[model samples]
Target: MRHLYIHVPFCARRCSYCDFAIAVRKRVPAARYVETIRREHALRREREPGWDTPLDTLYLGGGTPSLLPPGDLADLVTTFALNSDAEVTLEANPDDVTLDAAAAWSSCGVTRVSLGVQSFHAAVLEWMHRTHDVAAAERAVETLRAAGIGEVSLDLIFALPAGMEHDFRRDLERAIRLAPDHLAVYGLSVEPRTPLARWVARGRTVLGDDEQFAHEFLLAHEILTEAGFDHYEVSNYARRLPQGGSRRARHNWAYWNDAAYAGLGPSAHGFAEGIRRWNVREWVAYERAVARGNDPIEGKERLTPAQRALERVYLGLRTVAGIPAADLANPSSSRSFLAATDAGWLTTRAGRVYATPSGWLMLDALAAALTTSPEGG
Candidate 1:
């Protein structure tokens, strides 16, 4: 099955910690971006003729997808043969969700709304440089529900430099009170070149230490799980059985499964036919390429078997499904598997290995250990 992703690269303002390829400008080039996406889509269809394969999921993620004009957003929906039962999701920010906007999105086949409600605490929101206030987030959720959108997910951030244990717990409690179907909780990471990094470098901000973050992370996990949320992925929790117990964000799952997907728009990435390609990061360059009837893809990589295997382990380990036991039995991997199991971070039952809650926190280390050969040899 194929999944599709369309990137909307315009945001009103960049958050302090955001590192995604986004352009924050006063005026958004909605029309130009839509045209380029269509051109890219047409070119991809001509090469693969795979549009007929009903798309199981269509995700419109971005700088802020809700920033797009209603008409432009609807045009994107019309461009794809989204399966009748497709999980059409739109990633939106709280400030962008209006009653009219929510209705417009629902009319265009958006079945799920992922709202960016980083924090309900005003101080924390300000610290993170978010544009919306706590009230705006509440209104956004109410608006989506009022617009008849049943599946709502909220995105949250914790371990802010200004956050405390009580503050983190309060955020989780407030989010749960809103009753969203899913919650995407993330720990703040200071990416190089981001404002957060600059603040840390200049001693303007002091992030929570590793121990503090670990405590908060464990606390949030416990709280959410006790509240009946499934810690399906390290950072994501959902109440319902993921469109009927299917194991993940379908669009993202495609990447882990190494399935074909066509990513459209500037800075988007596509993987198909064993080749990975990415578009230019600048909108001007992307538009120019599309205007010239060129593919606009700036670079491509052909995956080696070793690279693909490494990717499988890397992605598989991040989810609750864990990696297959057979994949871990190679002589090179057996030692790390046994060590991790012994350490209580992983367990094997009925031939499938799964990570415990503690293991999820150190997933990267576990994955590295599993993929590495024993001994420096």
Candidate 2:
């Protein structure tokens, strides 16, 4: 595989809105986690032919990848056969960043760090159960710079509940002032069974409506683009270079382009040759499966032609590099193409149909309308 994603599921504390597969721990099991991953990789190498080949990108995403000790993190990255110029990314929390830790990460070949600075407001941070304060978040960015990391990406969450005290615009401005190389701006979703959902259900808090969500999304697009950041994907923006292109996240692009990637660790998903697979949801279950010399894959699906086509169109429309125009040659797509353009949802340029920020906010409905049929129905 050219790209690989290793999910590190250790977290110091679970964020209020988090429903991700994570094991909250007072003391992280760094060494044990690394050893488990090594075992899993070894097992995969035997079954998949090119699994051992050099990777173009390696993403260490997480509960908090930065929670691992620097030496342990280095060991995990070195375990992979990566291309010399491979883009290695680690997802970090602002409080976890230290100059020494960041320097060690760079020394071990981490070219990029994605900091989870959900919001710059202290109250919002506390409401979200984030471990760091605004000051720490700012310091983390400067520390990453001092460590000489090639790229720094900051994450922000907008469209919070009306009850929460936050100014989305101010947060955006603060993030821009920091001058991160990239930004991943996401809308706050009150996922089911999470603390946020419980609060909403009990009438303790209320999420914003679609209008608020749209407003915040558009506002981000305006501010970021005006600041010379390229809104390349639905929720991603990259700093545009003075001379030319933008500093896009290469690893994520692999997914947007439907390139096959291998995923390891609990709850990680992988897709190859039309088959999608995921590991066991719990860490203990995944570790046990690997220890027993069995594939940790809990289940897999081989998508049908129609399913694949719909997915292609859906994934394509989510990015700036949209699907080929010819892919939308169905009667349903052809009928709405003009209406969609007239509504300012998309634009056809250079033979590719690109979605505007507004269209991205309504990606699901738009993709469904434009999805092509396999049997020419």
Candidate 3:
């Protein structure tokens, strides 16, 4: 396996905009979850005997992975076979980060920490209901650095409510000043029936319009690129390593490259051998299923060839690596592809095709423009 992802689903409280499968309880079920994860790992290893699968990345993502004590995270790492220099990453809320916590993580082999800062602005943070204030978030970054965590990535949300009165440039500037090894700045989306969605539905909140969206998106591209960060993927940026390269999130890169990976724990998803699978979101049900020697997977599908091809085009366009020129320039989609080049939305260099910043803003259309029917017409 190229990567192993463990989903830690316990959170102190649900964020307003979150729709991830998580269990919010005052008393977290950390011990039970850790033991269950160990059992799941053993079961998985026994069923596959694939310990020989050399994993280069291990990502502990979640509702809140930093909620666990360092010991549990360490045990989880030992349970799997990992590369000597595997990039082990854990997602942490700002409030959970501390000098001691970071030291513990470093001691236990965690090489990266992704902090959920959301925003440095107080009102925006309030709207998101994040526990950590701007001061706390800033301190969290400093503390992680002081404890010697090699990489720290901050998460920021833009496109706030209409009257939120915050500047996107300010947020980007603050992020640059922090000099985090990585940054994930995403536009706020009100997913289905979450609290934010409900508020929007009731006309109690206003999501930014298209013009504001374009302004902020383009502004970030300019600012971040100027700051020497590589815009590696649509929403991700990586700092230039001292040795003259990017410290990109390898696990996430694996996903974009369509590499095989294992996903463990409730609500986790995995893609392997052309198959996509996911476990049940409910922890109790997932545990019972695993305990009874049943596969925790609630659903799975073998992607068709066409589906795979479509995913390749879509995902590739989302990154700086556009789909291969040869694959996309078939007779059928030639006109659309040529039109993009004519309009200065796409560019080709050396051998690979890449989307210009403007083209990236219209990724869905740009990717679709390269798709041809199975008959090659």
Candidate 4:
């Protein structure tokens, strides 16, 4: 596999809306976590020859990969053989960024940093229980750039709970002023069993309606695109280079392109040779399994032809790179495509169907309509 993902599951505290697999700890077991990851890598390499190949991208994502010490980050990164031009990324909390930390990461070959700057509003940050404030978010970007990191990506959340007094447009403007290489703009979701869900269930708060979601989504598309960022993916935007190149997140592109990748660590999922596999979600169980020299895999699925075809349509529609018309050869899919195009939700150019900004707002429903229809697959 040319792409590798390592999930670091330790977090200082769980965010209000997060449903990710994370182990909350007052003090992270940095050394132990590093050792377990190393052992897991060695074991996998012994069994799978694919693990020996140099990686084109290495993404350290999680519960705050920046929480790890710089030395530990270096050690984990050094374990893999990476291509000279490989994209190495780390997901960091804004408060975790420091000049020293950023410099050390750059020295150790981390080319990009994705900062979790969910919002610039103080009230929203408090409600979300984020560890960083507005100032830290801006400082993080400056630190990354000052340390010579090649790319900086900022994440922003909109469509907050109703009556929260959030100014999403202000957040977008602030992000643009920072001039990040990429931006991942997302709508707040009340995941089941999360604190936000509990609040909704208990009538403590109300999530925004569909109208709010669409309005904010379209606003981001408008604001970011106008600022000269390319709307490359449904929820992602990249700064356009002077020569017309882009700073798109190459690692995530692998997923959109349906390429094989290797995933290591608890709750990490990997796809290869037509099979999709995932490891146990909890860190304790994962570490124990690895310690016992057993695969920590919780389950796997071998995708069928129909599933793959549906994925091709669904995933392709989420990107600016539209799918070929041939992929929708079925009569039902063709009809839906025509209807969507007429509704200003899609535009066909050069035999490929691309989703307009309005269409991306309804991406899930549109993709579902195409796939669920009779003969869709």
Supply candidate 4's per-residue lDDT for 221.
Answer: 93
- Candidate 2, after superposition: displacement of residue 40 in Å? 0.5
What digit string (tens of lDDT, one per residue) describes model 3 on residues 201-265?
Answer: 99999888977877887888899989989998888999977688897899999898888888999
Q: lDDT per prediction?
A: 0.81, 0.91, 0.85, 0.91
Q: What lDDT is reached at residue 308 by model 3?
A: 86
Between candidates 2 and 3, the TM-score winner: 2
Of the two candidates 1 and 3, the one with more favorable lDDT, higher being better, is 3
| TM-score to true structure, per model | 0.93, 0.97, 0.96, 0.98
lDDT of 2 by residue, 1-377 (tens): 89999999988988989999998999988998999999999988887788878999999998999999999999999999889899999999998899999999999999999999999999999999999999999999999999999999999999999967789999999999999999999999988888988998999998899999999999999999999999999999999998899999999999999999999999999999999999998888888888888899999999998888888988898888987887777533466666678889888877887888888988887777776423332
Pitting candidate 1 against candidate 3, the one with the higher TM-score is 3
User: Which portions of model 2 show Cα errors greater than 4 Å?
Assistant: 330-333, 372-377
Candidate 4 lands at a TM-score of 0.98
- Give the range where candidate 3 is weakest over 10 consecutive residues by summed lDDT: 368-377
Off by over 4 Å in 1: 162-166, 241-248, 330-333, 375-377
Q: For candidate 4, lDDT tens digit of each residue in 1-377?
A: 99999999999999999999999988888888888899989888888879988999999999889999999999999999999999999999999899999999999999999999999999999999999999999999998999999999999999998899999999999999999999999989888999989999999998899999999999999999999999999999999999987999999988998899999999999999789999999999999999898999899999998788778878898898888877876533577766887899888888887889999988888887777776543
Q: By descending TM-score, how would the candidates be arranged?
A: 4, 2, 3, 1
